[model samples]
Target: MRRLACAPDTRPLISDRNHLGALAYCYATREEDCLPYRTARDFYARRVAPELPETVLTAILLVSPGRSLTRRGNVAELPRGKQWFDEGLPERLHHFCTDIAPSLCPTPPTVINTDGATPETVLAQVAGVLADAGLDQTAQRLASATAHAPRPPLDPRFVDTYTQLGGLEAFGHPFTPPIAHRGGTVQLCRLGAPHHDPAGHTRLWNPLGPGPWPPPGPAWSR
Candidate 1:
């Protein structure tokens, strides 16, 4: 369940029976709106794919909100004609199909459209995506979604830690810090199901683990 900010060239394909997921946000018109997206995609293909554990499941969300040049207001104007992509307006269609999809071995990448869905809907889509990827246990996935909001606050600490992992720089930029710093924030939202033993014992599951065993996250302690 590791999240890495990467470019298309470096993005890795999930090559095992593990459940995996990813989110990609692109601005169709303002393709240049966020240089980080392209950078992150490239990073994953080259550096991140090689080191992935064979048992890990992979999932990705590609969000491409069409770009616009209009400003929210004129009072805070910098350049009159300056253009920027609207924060969250356009719907994300299933675009940019990646080779990584077929690479998932037994599990395949599920492409979701963020066009008209709410955050909760999108999260649910992600859960379904992971399930289709062969990471069974959907009931737990629903429970995991309850513990937190659709969007989680970004933790800077996690970004820093991931950066230290070897070959991480492939995801970094020269003048700025790693794209993961920003993209990672969007990915910090924890959503998944709690792992339960056949005996009916509930346990915590951490999605961030590289292993394919039980998913990761805390269980409701009764």
Candidate 2:
């Protein structure tokens, strides 16, 4: 999306699939996801937070059930064919569609439920939602924000490392908002996930790697 905005004479685009949806689906599955909440948060921090004024999270709750029973395969005329939904997949989808997805947003997103609405109706509602969210003059807002995005706060524990590593340029900014993670304080930057462990050890998750790994420093080498 950002790349598109940079196209000469191109206008800002409306992105349908944002981190919000991906996070919701990832949570719904609850698998050993390699890039779950972390991916979503990074995107929010790097792109959405600075570019957009407001967010719109659409919930197509009806698809949860419909997906499970939908037809598939070549020609795909018969029910319970290819793409047969997994057991509990529907439930999880429904749960995410209705509940968990909305909670993760920094602010409550304006949700539009497209259970049984026509295309015209959905489009109209979305237009209203965009207007209410004050998303007018997208190009202007994006340009301005790029120049002066609100400085997201940093975890004090990470201040020294961030400074040494080259603050905004090398580490980018704090991707995740202030949130408690599993048994530790986690703050993600562009380069890595800096964690202040409850056991009093600091570690980092390599965002570019497959998973968490030791960071470069005298302390971690030990």
Candidate 3:
């Protein structure tokens, strides 16, 4: 079985496959505002869809409490010819939609109103459902990744760099969160073993500083 890995910073969502050989990508909105279908469709097409693997068979959008999945207009309906699902908490829907029936289900994915749940909570619940459905390996992988997901620093510049370089998996956790140093700010993160530097630290340059500056001290032999 392929181990489910953490979603990269560029995509703030989880992607995994169920035991039935169906692929799913789940996203939880950070804010409480509901997005219209057109906006959602465009965002998915431009930002999410391109990042999805060819194997993906469905897309799920999870939102927080007080939020809804609204149509583009009062009479507008969800765009046709796409396998999209909306739910407050994915685990709840898992029971009813065990089999992948994208082609058969003509109706749009159901819209769920999460009473008041956090993204972390939704992810944990979905992981549990996967475990119950005999996808223990995937469940464990998702749980582990969720637990160690990196928290972005407050600085917008650092956040941008982290997202660009890839999140926890690429840069590991921030050993030293963004902090001011040497007349500028710096963030020290440990890289994944595959890409860790000789010194075992990945130094992110302050976005506020000049461009293309070399490492402060002696450069490691590449």
Question: Highest TM-score: which candidate?
Answer: 2
Instruction: Provide the clashing-pair count of each candidate structure.
Output: 37, 0, 0
Question: Which regions of candidate 1 are displaced past 4 Å?
Answer: 1-47, 67-108, 132-222
- Model 2, residue 178: C-alpha shift (Å): 43
What is the alpha-carbon lDDT for the whole of candidate 1?
0.37
TM of each candidate vs. truth: 0.32, 0.39, 0.26
- List, residue by residue over 1-222, the lDDT tens digit for candidate 2: 001111224444566456665565555544452356567666766886565443333323244456345422223232212122444645666676566655544455555555566545655555554444454455334333333346568867767766664455445557565556665556765553233333433334332334434455522110
The pairs that clash in candidate 3 are none
Of 2 and 3, the candidate ahead on TM-score is: 2
Candidate 1, backbone clash total: 37
Global lDDT of model 3:
0.39
lDDT of 3 by residue, 110-187 (tens): 222334766666556666655644556766776666544566443456665556544444445555456767667776
Off by over 4 Å in 2: 1-13, 30-64, 67-84, 136-222
